[model samples]
Target: MAMAMAKLWMYCLLVCLGMALNNVASAQGVNPFEPDGGRRREMVPAMFIFGDSLIDNGNNNDLPSFAKANYFPYGIDFNGGPTGRFSNGYTMVDEIAELLGLPLIPAYSEASGDQVLHGVNYASAAAGILDITGRNFVGRIPFDQQIQNFQTTLDQLADNLGAIEAAEALGKCIFFVGMGSNDYLNNYLMPNFPTRNQYDGQQYADLLVQKYNQQLRTLYNLGARKFVLAGLGRMGCIPSILAQSTAGSCSEEVNQLVLPFNANVKTMMNSLNANLPGARFIYVDIAHLFEDIVANARTYGFSVVNRGCCGIGRNRGQITCLPFQTPCENRDEYVFWDAFHPTEKVNIIMARKAFNGDPSIVYPINIQQLANL
Candidate 1:
């Protein structure tokens, strides 16, 4: 035990020293790796994450959800093996946290003590904004429930730091939401659900946005101020959808379904920022970024953008990446990691763009600017 403690101390010291050296290097001049600043900096004290498998990290590991990704092959390219991130390595939030000069946020299920100070990730695999969205997955926490979990985290924070300090800390933190994929994949588009028969694509989007509005307002009331809401990516381009396509191309019909959701969210964001005092919301154009990547694959070093890196059946997307499955060797050159998730390489690209891009990709203000504000 004493030896382990000594080793831990040494490791922490080395990490701290490396960070100090990185800051020194940045202070001298610009580094391409650090986009927000030359010198390393912490833009926000904490960053609270929400949503589904896209940014899940490891929150669903203990849950009974089939969406969990803690087994082998899932994290083949990450820090050794699986840390519950859907990506091969880091998720978008992981890269975003690094950009913020903060350590990776702990899963809400595992966080304790000072861990909450940095923030907590409440995202779960197969979870969605609607309570019934991922019901097929059994134990996945929905967005509303994720928020409720966060509220519990807040209560714990208040317990540790007192109410005033906790509230102040929360008000200044960045709130990130990246969801809605499962709602389309597992609920609306699924033949088992009556969603398609009951409502058209645009009307479904409105329903989602309305519930989303209430969810975001709830977060606002809970002291969240800065927000980064990632618009849905082109669902039709995913490996799962491509596998279902007879032409082995992106399904324009499925793609059209998501367009209205992203559009309405932008309008909702504008309204939210305008009405909520001190609230600053940044809308990230994920579909735009992804479409560009697919269109210009060679420019981005991707040789295969339609199929996933791992899975079974057509496009390796009929099923999610399976356990012990030998993932593709050239993971960096692929866009999708599995049926429903992007490779870590792509995740980094998305995070970086959302962190610093202009209005073309991120509207109003980018994450870096929002963090600075």
Candidate 2:
């Protein structure tokens, strides 16, 4: 009875807190849950994306890689249809671009000439911090290569707008980067790779941060000032990891493995902000944001959390969604779109939260505040 009463009190406390937050939103005349809530006109001049499949857009469409998603079912709900995006609809960055009052940032592979003036997305499927990270996927562009591609884009901008104007434009743009998941999913965890036999989890995290630090510095040198670094989400809770579980539960071991990486990256944020003058870095707490959505799945209108909306075997994760495969009718109710990615609804929620959420979700300041700065 005591335990039950304690639980009840905790529940009531959460309810009261939610009500208070809602009341604050009402008083301020800005509903955070709404899409247009805190949008104060166009925020950033442009947004340049660099990451893995989570925000790839269409960089892998023409690449001879197995990780490409330019087929049916992948973009069944999307207006363009299978534009190399892993999700059925929009990626998190796509939603973020819209929130910033800009059109979808074109992929680096496809954008040409003045098309990249607004910004360019160099994210690719199966890319990682390490250059040799995604060798299994023959044609995937690694993080270093992506940076080189951005340099090429910068040259193009310089040629078109002159060096001074290009520098000023890029300074006001947002650099949205979400990497490291492939380092864990494709390199560290894969049996085919020898990453695990290499350094242990802590050592690996250090190596990644060490390399990532230099890479970010390169981007800073190239004129990127406002940086939004999205940390790894709960990879162990995804359908691919859960499918490997006999008990059909999230892989706690896998979760613990990546914790150090996120912590180190968070610590690195303060270092970058302090050391790199004119460079403002903000860390997005993807792990916590994903956890809250899963924990409160019902409240968020999600019914299926452990399995993918479209896949083959146990938890529908043995194989990723195939071409022409029909997905769940209720896409909004399903959290996982494939064995490894989230649905469009989930993307919208995450983008919104990171854009305007409190300090707990996005440290130092959220995306909106960072843009204004």
Candidate 3:
């Protein structure tokens, strides 16, 4: 009887250990933000970026607007100076440039002499898919206006290189669009706005997605073929939203809005693929990647999953996050760079996911998959 009892205890212990081991393996294996298995091949000769602050390398800051980043502490960690990026260091554009063996694409607002011949960033801090969304944020450029800027830049490029050569260069280029976060967060969620108290969450999302599709179709008409469309990240869990919600937990109401918005984006991409000729629309799921990092922070060596590295106060969502503000000693452990944007380390993780061909996070295809297409 004693021997039988001993065997039973040992078996149970083994089972528990096995379960723990499996959990650990699962955590490590399924990190969607991890770098892809592809070697950095020169798939696209150049990259043109459009959208909002998430990918903005400092275009809006140069313009006469409150939504700017061309100041001290904004780029303290990036080349030891302000290069117009919202983060302390390099953004997705810079990483993509490195991956493609190209120089950093200059901001469209930068001096004409300083602009890069190959690429430019038309992203403004408060820009969005719709012109109406731009008015919500102080000093933000509208989407249609941004397209005009791109047209001007393209014309200049054509002047430097012949029109045919410029066309060829653009054909070999990849265009990356990262917008919509501000439209939902700054506009629809504002206390004074009717959307905050009036519209159903899903209905509001549908409206935004409809606007996004129109803007994307416009880009496609403008000779943009190879494309990367980044969806909204985990906005509900962002420190700014958490601070606003009654409970410190992520706002499910807001998350509900995000789900359908992302779904519509996926549907739009599918339609574009089916209808448009040579259209390679890739959707990068920024929200899912962010959720994975926050849910399993330990696997990513992050100790603190919540809270921004910058100060947290009543005005933390707005007035705080300045150059003089206190920053975390180890930024890698913190998911947010400021109240609104991501830290450089977190952006690196996102870039890796963007590189991967994961369908859940990256749709249509990733950098490797796009190479074949």
Candidate 4:
């Protein structure tokens, strides 16, 4: 009994020493590993992704949303075929997961207690920052609903691993928010509502930014410390917008309208950093990266930057690729796979850049660095 007591005392002493070291490291502005949360083989213990079709994966499969892509050709290049990813293969988050040494995280609806310990994806196709953004697509999960689901996931996390352990793990994880495109495509531009009349372009963007800031704060309250907020790309450069232009050039008018949203988002990230203690926010500049790709298509090994690899109208942006539609023979040569999404190859490129690109693309820090933090 004496020997056992001695051993217990030694262990306690070692644990206390470790805690002191960690506290010192943290005080010096460095992230030190926690005893329970830092044992993972991956850079990040887990990644909780929240967004729209850009990183949907398969969450919208059962959401009754017409904005689903759980069909053939959508995932023709991905494993298990049509896993509901909007891209031909892996989505942006999928590539990031692979780089982080994790398997594809299960969708929120498909994940259970233990399965969610690794992570859960709350992204849904057609979902946006605004609740009514994707309402046209019947049954879409809005941003608010996604956050509620995340709360549910948090409850499950606490249940599975105990509250302390679960919270620790989440602190070491990544929270990626890639929504807002649909707020423009499916809401502002949609003529059904009086949104256009209610607020001009810049006013509408400011409104979205205000709501986005609140949503992000809600996530922080839910234990998300590291945030990856994707800024909007050039909406007018997509095939759908190009089809609307008689000259087949980008609609500069639409482009200017969308610029303020991205600017506001960057400002929000800065504000979040200043106001939220211990929070790290990284902004992704998709517009600049996209413009570079289109401007230097040949240099980037892309043969077509103005048209979709699979579609029916001018530049193939008039309508989304239909079921069984024949895709281009050289998919890698096209910047876009469909009217609305990038090809698998482009997804890989973007993921690689975001993982380790310069400040021009991923400002403040790259995803790899974000994961480490």
Candidate 5:
């Protein structure tokens, strides 16, 4: 009887040790932005993306909006056809899908034709964190309306995956939100909007942060736990802004606006994380990363960084970089794909920086580190 009791005690001890080890492994493996590294965890089986043209694959093509990219040259390099992405080929979203071992997520507009699977993109070009950004543009989907579309997409997913499964999917899935560039470029800086006089740079930035927090909280309430929040890129250095300055240099005026804006966003993320439980918000600093690549092109194996390859003139603004426009023979030399967007090679570099946990490029914490959280 004594020996049997001793064996039972030993077995219990072994079970306890096993449980502790498993817990450590699980904690170490948890990735908020992506699935666990090895032997993919089936937890987040989908990714629901929302934002602006940076992520908008083809949503605006169907929508009655002036901010449309569902035509030639937009997707010219993507499968030799227009996929509505404002790039020569795949976007950051497409790369994320590839990394997650998932199929390309269809646009929310095209969700009708698909098998109702993993994910859909609801990003619209010229959309902003604030509803007014779209309204100011006159005929674009507002951020609030975009969220409504997200709700519709979720409803359909729930119908297919069942309510509980849909909720689980959303809770575990990665939510990629990339926006705010248009808010600065189109709405606030356009000089016609009352917002320009109503709010100074700091005040405007604060307003945007508030809007972001409210929208994020809404998504959180809707069962979103994992979020990949991409901050605004360097607006001052874009080809268009350079052309506006006419100095053949980046616009300090625009940079001044963006600097405080990014700072406020960082502060907001911190406050949100503190307030919300189990909230994994990873801020991808696209500005700093792009700046580094542009400033030190040789370090990253690029030949040119100041001007775009596709467009003409010193500022890449002789004309809009359409299909008929003459493209530089070597695309790898330029940092920008067009007057406004980065080249595919640049996006790939940014994605690598995001995945590798570059502290400077990814503020607070990297996406991979956030996943561990």
Candidate 6:
């Protein structure tokens, strides 16, 4: 045990020294990791993703739930047709994986054997931060359950590569978490659920932030060192929320409800970065980015900002895109793909922004910078 502690200490010391040298090289406008030809290489060892349908690749297909999306028009543009991704093509994490020079991370439900070595996506449709948040969906994997799945993956990895080696590999990988949207969309805002009557918006945000802190700490304890926590996007402008509006406009009330949650999460991220040893945390200002895209829809080549490409009723959101439904001809010019999710184009833009955009949107540092560190 003493020998193991000494070895861990020596490894940490060397990592810190290397980071310091990298910072110096960065200040001199030179990237030590980059070759002369500027070819992109895998930035991190691997990327483990956790979130809801926004990033869920295929974790909900086998589950007996209403949130399943492994059918037509869902993965219409993907090379692998109808692979359970909520979007038409790639998700935000898929884009990030591509930008990182890594293949798309497979879903936890589908990942097997050596596939687990690269990474696994535990995000599920309708999953939320709180355990009870997604009960309406009946079979969704909440944040806690997702972590358990990751633990199972870790056990498999440990059997393949010894415990110490697995830990070392995980420490160098990226942990991307984009939860909490379902906590609001599927729980707090749902009339059948008593979340609204139980607590006001601010109190609910506080409760979520508290629980999220615990959940993230649990990951840190299990060898996750680098984290990218994506903040909730502009839910008010979503097709579903917009459909509820009498006038054809964004719902300010709904948008205001999510502000506290995003703000609290940012505070929690800063606290975690300060408190956790060897752990780094960054926040993605998803709301701001979404708003920017909506505000300048034309600039981003999006024409329809208030309706879905394949949904029905008002704003094409009252009923989500039905199975076998034909999507819009100009899929590239739409902001939303369904009532609750954005189009692949929008996902690509969001991923690009979070990957290398300015620090104002992706707080502290972007994904590329986080990978380098």
Can you write out model 4's per-residue Cα lDDT over 3-90, one digit (the tens) per residue? 9999999999999999997886555442122324433446777789899998888888887778888887788788798878887788
lDDT of 6 by residue, 1-373 (tens): 9999999999999999999977764554421222231223466767999999999998999999989899998999999799999999989999999998677999999898767666899999999999988788899999999999999998987886678877877887899999999999999999999989999999999999999999999999999999999999889989999899888688888889999999999999989999999999999999989989988999999999889999999999999999999999899999999999999999999999999999888989999999888
Give TM per candidate.
0.89, 0.89, 0.83, 0.88, 0.84, 0.89
Q: After superposing candidate 5, which stretches have Cα over 4 Å from the reference?
A: 1-43, 113-116, 134-137, 312-314, 369-373
Q: For residue 251, what is the lDDT in candidate 3?
A: 77
* Lowest summed lDDT window (length 10), candidate 3: 30-39
Candidate 2 lDDT over 1-373, as tens digits, reads: 9999999999999999999877765654431212234422356667899999999988988889999899989988899798999999999999999988777889999998757755899999999999888888988999999999999988987876678877876888899999999999999999999879988999999999999999999999999999999999999999999999888899888899999999999999999999998999999999999999989999999999999999998999989999888889999999999999999999999999999999999998999899878
Instruction: Write model 1 residue lDDT over 1-373, tens digit each, in one string.
Output: 9999999999999999999998776665432222232343466768999989999988889988778899888888787689888888989999999998778889998998767777899999888888889788888999999999999988887876678877876776889998888889989988888888999999999999999999999999999999999999999989999999777888999999999999999999999999999999999999999988989889999999989999888898898888888999999999999998999989999999999999999999899999888
CA lDDT of each candidate?
Answer: 0.88, 0.89, 0.73, 0.85, 0.75, 0.90
Better of 3 and 6 by lDDT: 6
* Cα-based lDDT at residue 91, candidate 3: 87
Least well predicted 10-residue stretch by lDDT in candidate 4: 30-39
| Number of the candidate with higher TM-score, 1 or 4 | 1
Clashes of 6: 0
Residue 173 Cα positional deviation in candidate 6, in Å, after optimal superposition: 0.5
TM-score of 4: 0.88
lDDT by residue for model 3 (23-46), tens: 765543321111232222345656
